[model samples]
Target: MASRILAISGGKGGTGKSTVAVNLAILLAENYDLVMADLDVEDPNDHILLGVQLQNEKPINIMLPFVRYDDCIKCGVCGEVCDTGAMLISPNGLPYVIPRLCSGCMSCYFACPTKAIVRGERTIGYTYETLVQLDGRSFRLVTGVLREGEEHTPPAVIAAKERALLTDGDFYLIDTSAGTSNSVATAMDGSKLVLAVTEPTPLGLHDLELILQLTSKMGIETWVIMNRSGLGPEDEHDRVVRNYGSRIVARIPYSKRIVESYVKGRPIVLLDPSSKEASMFRELASMVKEVME
Candidate 1:
């Protein structure tokens, strides 16, 4: 059978999206084979939070344009047509490239009349794969890490997602970056469902609609997981979710146990299966199983 993907995402950061993803992955892995991928390329810390070292590193490289200075012509066309401003025409009429500014869209390469542009590669980030286990049951974790100072993240997200697909699993859970940017969309794309994690604060409520709008457009099954639920007014959050045609599937209350478990790199579900948070994850996993069925 093909893998069923569940995307854990939200527009606000610090909402415990990764925590939910990791714990839920542990719970789900017990029954269904699981591969959890962290697509938050700008700052991926799932391995850190899970307290496991990332292994099997694969480079995610982007195209960079190298100018051949020896070429006879110093046309400014490449500079003018460049979308990311990576190509620049010097005062001496020679075209040079700023590698960091490049988006690798290849517009400058096609626009160069002198054929002076040579394709080069720059490592934007890396994709890593590792195995984690709960009891005897094990699941794979694929993480995307963007190199420091890299601004473009969509390529890294795509690369990590593709690597995750290479693994065998009955289900795939993707943890996406905050906000509804192109990078988030890229990571959450093709999900069987998007389980959005959010807080009950006004900021969380405010950003909730943005992600809903994106998922609603994609026509994916959507669920809201209110992380730190009951910390603030949930009525507004519910109203916003109902307006978007999604329902609240689960709520995790604020607790110090969760904090300590996160800091200790142990999933709450594994720490205390009888705990409310652990049970909540099991409940969520059951719902996912039903959906897949």
Candidate 2:
């Protein structure tokens, strides 16, 4: 059978998206050959949590605008068209490019009548591939890391996703950047299903609704994982999930053992496969396999 991409995402950060992704990948690999793609270019830490070094690194660059003074008109059109404020008109009326602010959408370039904008490449991030072996089961992990100063994340996310697709696997599990912004959409673009991880806090529920709205628009199946389930109000969270037509497939309480496993650079699932936490992940994986099959 051809491979499918299953995305694990959440609207807010620190909700354990990466942890769920790595553990689910580890368990799923037992039944199906898998590749895990970490698309959170902003703060990728799957390798850290998995305790594996990234291999086959590749730099990713984006197009930066080069302004030609010769063809320049003092027109404010470039600045007006720049959504990211990368292009700005100086006091003298000439537009200058701010590389960090540039999303490389080329909107300014297209909107410029003088053709003063030229495309230049800037190395913004890197993509990495490594093999992770756990309990005699191995799977490939592809991670995208954005440079510290880079503002645009979608390109890096796209680059890492493409790298994961090149590998041979029965299932490609995608760990997306937090939030329901365009970058997250880029990572979740072709996913077969999305496991949306969130907590029961006010912030968590707020962002969860936003992501659910996005996925509903995309017409993708999404299941909720109530991470840190006992931290806050569950009734409101349940109402929100019910309103979105998404079921809460799993609930993981905040546990010190989970924290210890994270600190020790080992998945809790690996620490004791027979434990309740590990069984939760295994059952989830089994449900996914059944659905996909």
Candidate 3:
């Protein structure tokens, strides 16, 4: 089996990237061993959509400030060495460290003259891996959850991808966050192909362009999925997208049954792969397999 990594990303939120990724993983798992990674560390929803309980969640740690006050002369060296403004020097000549602003570069601790700064660990996120069996076939699901108020999603996303790679599966489907930020880039770095999920709305087309630009810059092959295709008669957006050299591999039509089944945590493909939406997705998956082969 060949290693094939597919990253599902969109530049904007509510574009159904996770939905496409999850369903694609479930469908592909029928013929290939699948490792599905939820790299949307900021707010992972793949597990929620799959209705699978995430077990063995291990906390992911980040380096934080550990101050040694005993050896202290009130030196501001740590504050001056910090670039993120995580460390602050008080008017009274005391130094304070804000963990939130810290990037864990350890520059402050390295530059501290009094050796008063030390590295400490903070729980920035958690990662979990589980197996979901559908139709007598089991697929692996790995996800990372970044603690709210933390800003280091890129690392967590990378960690989750690394964990997924350990599954040694033939197919790896990565569900990325909704943005073209560093986190999305990190999640998409090593993908063999990327499928950008979008709706037929103006906002969806707008972000699809942004994500396409990102993928172009990265030299990654990309395809678009125009979800909710019948929501409106805006064919111009689709035309504009194709003009940019990316093709729409699938168009999932808007259906109340799809929405309700999604709310109930069921994969649309499983409900009926012969349905209009699922058939389109299957066609998309077939195209993906052809590309990989």
Candidate 4:
């Protein structure tokens, strides 16, 4: 079966995109094969939130420069060719390579005349996979965790996505980082559809607009899910969101029970599928299916 990759994204943090992505994948796994990937490598929380113990933690390596001191010409060629400023030429004309700023492009190594630079691998993050059982349906949860002090989230996101692509499934639910930067863009690339989760608060509205703007520019079809809906009533936020021409596929009302279940690491759908929040998610799944069909 053709895989339906759905990217869950929001421009700002604390919008519940990962919560929705994980639960939606669990819900869909009841009748279809599903693989849920947490592409937010900088702060991966899906596995923790799901209470799944990851077993296979594999290191993600990226290229770094290894200077061959014996072959060095002290020409400062590597520093000049680094586009990311990873290599710095000191006042004394000595080159210093900063591993963090390096994008693993290896351009400096290839451009060196004396072959003084050699390409080496550095561990930037780790990719993990685990099997989670939700409501008797078993599904895979894969995530990438970037090491502290690392600025490359896009590479780790790509590593997690590559692992997800290896699994054959009916659906791939990708939970992206909360931003408009390269990390979010890398996760959403090649996705068939995107679900932008937002809240009714002022900040939520602003970030939702930003996310919508970015997604529209990518030519990707998007649907919005307004969380904590009815916090203020009168559908003011709904009207404002609709003005952007994107339909609100679902609205999960603010509920203490939903929050409590999430804190307890239990799927709200399992708590009571007939509850308001659970029903809202079900409606969301149905709407997505209709669109994909």
* Index of the highest-lDDT prediction: 2
Error of 4 at 275 (Å): 1.0
- Show the colliding residue pairs in model 1: none
Per-prediction TM-score: 0.96, 0.92, 0.92, 0.93
- Model 3 regions lying over 4 Å from their true place: 70-77
lDDT of 1 at 137: 74
Residue runs of model 2 more than 4 Å from their true location after superposition: 1-3, 73-76, 111-114
- Residues 1-293, candidate 4: write the lDDT tens digits: 24588899975758888778877877778757888899888888888778788868899999999888788778988888898999988887677888989889889889989988888999999998888886689988888899999987878888999998787777888899997787888888888899998888778877887887888888888888888778755265567567667788887888898788789988788776788788778878877777655
Error (Å) of candidate 4 at residue 271 is 1.8
Can you list the residue pairs that collide in candidate 2? none
What is the C-alpha local distance difference test score of each model? 0.87, 0.89, 0.83, 0.83
The collision pairs in model 3 are none
RMSD of each: 1.5, 2.1, 2.2, 2.0
